[model samples]
Target: MSLGAKVAAGETRFTVRSPHAAAVDVCLFDGTAETRLPMTRDGNDWTLAVPGDLSGTHYGYRASGDWAPERGRWFDPAKLLVDPYAIELDRRFAYDPRLSEYGADTADLVPRAVVQGALPVVPPAPPRFARGGLIYELNVRAFTMLHPDIPAAQRGTVAALAHPSVIAHLQKLHVSAVELMPITAWIDERHLPPLGLTNAWGYNPVAPMALDPRLCPGGVAELRETVAALHAAGIGVLLDLVLNHTGESDVHGPVLSLRGLDNAAYAHEPNGALINDTGCGNTLNFGHPAVRALALETLRHFVRHCGVDGFRFDLAPVLARGPGFDPAAPFFAELAADPRLADRVLIAEPWDIGPGGYQLGQFPANWLEWNDRFRDDVRRFWRGDVGVGLLATRLAGSADLFGPDCRSVNFLAAHDGFTLADCVAYEHRHNHANGEDNRDGHGENFSWNHGCEGPSHDPRVNAARAEDLRAMLGTLFASTGTVMLTAGDEFGRTQHGNNNAYCQDNAAFWLDWAGRDTALEDHVAALSAARAARRAEFAQFPQGGEWLAPSGAAMTVADWEDPASDGFDYHVGGARHFRIRRAERSAAI
Candidate 1:
């Protein structure tokens, strides 16, 4: 811990917490070649005396110790292991069982070597994030794929996010934080690739700390630069963290990172079998102390090294669930108390596939959740279903869901489901592209085809769909609670009939840089204009507001259920809509 012992000009001192490894070598690489230097063990630490390795040197770890799989140690001297703190990766991981510990289970494959910054990692981010902050959800690839101004080399990577075009786009949108889909290193489901598809959105996480090579431009600095640019624009970046489960497929899944490092720590399956909660193959058990430590360390590492402003937990409720998905689990409470994460902008997906798993308003006040009810209601109303009264309840922040203080994150669409355009153009999910035979997406989209399915030449139908788009997005941005608009929603991008294109690599999911509709663009502009006008007049976050329902409609759960009886109905879709009134009581933001 002292600088008295100086390192050579290119030589660096290194340490690891593996006393059991008979020998540890620092495998150094200078972009092209690699050299191995041995490390000596002293007590619990292994110290490496490298021969002057430069900053950009690519490197990995080589440990000579136990190689037993059953006992949980898979150290192989032949394999060049990647450092957990790697800042850069050379390539995206291909979904091969060779990447896994077993043949196909992802819970077994470890990460590849990457270059990290030479400076020491910083401490945790300040525990400070404003409540009622507007969150913008986006997928890294989709957000910039069609951007004309973004450089082709940087497009779709973390570097693309920092481009002026991206920054300008977000500023225009006016959302405070950007909730990015899982950026951590992950692998697409094997079925998709053979079907000629790529995992467009990274939901299946392999290594929580490793950056997905596909999205990395240079290294951690690529992320740092992107975050810095966003901060300069007064925007925060909230990573959609995947902790509930891993990319590791079912019992026949691959063996990647954690499965190789310590499967017992990361894998949460009871009796070493998969739990279907995450809908992913395996889950991370909160019961293990090491798992908790590693998870916490991973979070701390991200905040320190990556400059992430906040984390949107993919399956936050799973973190709180006990042995049997109990609500008051220690993990949630622990994260709430951890100084590292307490004041962070914690958002949750709020539900998993587990039994009794949907806890909409159950999370504590510190956390905001993806309000599925809001999406359903708004979609129902826009799609012109009957009984559309509940639209106001959702637009009013779902007091039914959020209660006295907690606010729900309401949205019309997100990365996981149907896009706003698809919500109207397509009636049912077209997930045949995902190789699940159309069974991958939800059947109940709550979307209407407006008297016609798919695209139409009838200007009336087009006009109707356009109106529906405005109504939904307008309501989302103009509502109470923290609003989260998906990346492509603003431009009214459509995924054709592919509602659930989780694994479509082709042009089907990519943003069409050339085919933008001007009318829809104006609609998006109007939505932003409304939000900005209101936001400028009323203080953001925590200051009160009264959405004085414009039509002078009073909202209640009863009225929302039956639209014809009241003015509107969110469930069956109706005619009447409600508005709000802002209370600008506080001057201080």
Candidate 2:
């Protein structure tokens, strides 16, 4: 039987895989009335079929069995369990510990799943982007929260992206693809409400398939319409999905969906404690066939129902961590063989906090990886600590780390770190507002404050910072692989030195639409155009490139060893060449 509630042949059927449940019931709601129907079990799956169409019906699951936290068997019948494959949700999940307690009933506070019709099928279209294209990553909410031109009602929703102002800005940036942060439904951290904070980055997901009602009030149809609008404008959409873990934190966390249905779906130790590989309470159990099937089902849902162009997997290494990291994992092979995801893009974060987790360049050939090496090395070069030789390697595509067939996704800063402007103005992380006593965020940012911390009014200081920003942008564009720019980095967006602004969703994380450096914005646009044209030219002439001295001779080892060496040329065969040079504390493209 297929998972989730599906309608077919004038009847509605509810099927769920509960491997260890002794009893399962489907709780159907009609207005204020509630009806509980017993489910028939065969092996591990439970099935319940009704005689009429349940198109507008809402329902949930109740699995009853032994409750042994230490043994990892959490079966709370009082708690209404959500279907892992629910396409539509009636309300957001409200957190209450009683829902997970062994004998407490919290039906009124739980969220209900709505039965949806089959997804509409559309003719397949060619991908709008390929490797070596620029990707602009932005959160759907923060990107338009303060936009002056967007309508008041649609300001921070998915529909805002289709506005003329938003589309025009993306067009001007010349970005080939737009990577949106997670739009799926998520829960706040267990301790957040008490501390007066909320999950803004959407990394703590609870439901992988249902759209967050707050972000998309218009539901899945709105998302489909938005995708169509972007495709019409020649832009592709990539969603940042969280499949490695769920919002169900440690054993003390709420019993929302997965845990109540089957605790075995999560990774566990020999003692049956949850595995903390993802640093997020529970790591998914890819070792189980049913867990892997759920992941595949979610991927196909987004591609076939929502029509997204690609996916950026968060904490991706967890998917292949079968005892240890394996390149030929079952899920990877399953994805490669699936015809539904043939032309869709697939990118990975490439690392986690678990042992043997940093598997950079170890993914399958079809996947692109986030190059932390490129990000750190480039930052160090611009900070004046590293020399041009290191920059040369990164600019040429970090061949030391990646195979020739795998493309690198280079970036300087992303949502988790300080903004581009903050990178040059803050040497220390100022995360006092995050309520962790300044103990949160990364300690080693490889940043420089240029003789001052935070903001400054000195003309010489401002001028120096401005020039360094341009040089770094120029270097990124001149590099040979795909590049990604944060939402407001082009015009010097700042977060006041908060490196980890994931919890600071206010002005610190939102983009300032009105206050932009027009000059810097124009410079970014020009660099993007140059990169596209240069990439095309390099494809035709793949060889005959070498390092050259500033004096027009082949560079020697002694030249590279010189501490004061500020510039060198990457001379292509024939008369073509590219240069990154610094003179008098200012670099030029």
Candidate 3:
């Protein structure tokens, strides 16, 4: 709130935070020409006032100081840095070797932060989404790029989500909330540009608050209008945010934004080596007050301006890590105390590549977690590698993992891995196209090929795969607690067994509406209706339920422990019954 360009009266004031810089300059751009204005230093902040209203002005920052990377002080005036508080940009970031060069001028390569005028803030209201409802996770660009009804000009943009056909499909699935993948401004990784590939997923973010111009040409207004449309259709929106690391990357990485302004914003060891808790080069230091402030401001900005319901944090453990993961971190306390974010739905991915990072079911009581245990255990159960006991535990909300309350967001597949269709059609990962020699993505997927690998022309193998998908969907719908279905999974979308398809921005990752399985989609709709009808029962674990065998006899411990046990009937107080049979590969709810 104290930083960034703000217009008051007839003059515009610009403020930035760079405690390590000896001096800072605000670079104002008029066409191709630039004029640098020196800012007054006061403690950790720099301020400058310009004459007249500069609301539509494009500007950047250049901090002058030592270029010592070993001591964590990287202040290079040659590399023009973006504002950490920028909500809009003149263009999207592009990868350039000059960005990391010490003396090479980067003014021509970096994106300029556009000074925005006042924005309309949505009135405070309770989130339209609730617990125990379905969350449909989707990639905005990929999800709409292949849709037939959306206009060609609107495809692959945030405005496409507001299309009537898209809303109709969401309404048909009874989606409680649509969890959109990152729409924030991001840059391609250093390696991708050389390899002729790009980071299709927007996980590698730079400006935390800025919207990517490529995905959102209309800026904040585009997002605000889309949110209003989804809300009007009774579907909430949740953004998947990446606050753990920036696209600036590691020691040899680019000198952009925070790294150029104050390298201390990143976590460093005693010897000044960057701490890579996120496996994404460098991790943000949550211990720093500035980092926490930026994060809080970002959350409030989205909630106030765009009217988003909540956020799903990617690599969430970094948010709670100061140097070590702590349950009582100040960030958590601050988020709870802030009135703006207290009521928003918080979901955590719950793990990272850091020390002691696997904190599943350890988040705050009010937060929901993506339960990988549910995903793996369900996959193993259908693959016949595990018995019904493990499946039953996941179905009953995994009380063993989260105690009595159910905060698990049960999901079989997500954007990062193989789709539900691929889970039954591939025994091994087929990611040779990723250019990593099949070394990327998870090795053990707990998948099966049903007597045929990849796509098959045999009708019997296709039938088996379809049956397995229906059974899994039935299990997810019948399970307790909130559930999530990745976009296009309801209609059998496939990434061709590419578990790590973050770079396949082409036809490989886009949803094929023309070739979608309509029968499977109809089955999902029916399952959603059934869950909605019994919403009360699915909200929590069923009480006084009897587990019976297929022959109408009570299930015993031996039956549950038997790996050959194919199916069982669950009767909840005789009001509702769920039948699952593996022999026929069918589930009746």
C-alpha TM-score for every candidate:
0.82, 0.97, 0.99
Which stretches of model 3 miss by more than 4 angstroms? none
Query: Candidate 3's residue-wise lDDT over 119-185, tens digit each?
Result: 8999998998988999999999999999999999999999999999999999999999999999999
Better of 1 and 3 by lDDT: 3
**Count of residue pairs whose backbone atoms collide, per candidate:** 47, 0, 0
* TM-score quality measure for candidate 2: 0.97
What is the lDDT of every predicted structure here? 0.65, 0.83, 0.92
Q: After superposition, how far is residue 432 of candidate 3 from its true place, in Å?
A: 1.7
Task: Give Cα distance to truth, residue 139, candidate 1, Å.
Answer: 1.9
Pairs of residues at least 3 apart in sequence or in different chains that clash in candidate 2: none
Considering summed lDDT, which 10 consecutive residues are worst modelled in model 2? 535-544
TM-score ranking of the models: 3, 2, 1
How high a TM-score does candidate 3 get?
A: 0.99
**Can you write out model 1's per-residue Cα lDDT over 96-215, one digit (the tens) per residue?**
645544222221233445434354454565532355446778788887777889888878898888888778777776667888887877777766667777777788876567788778
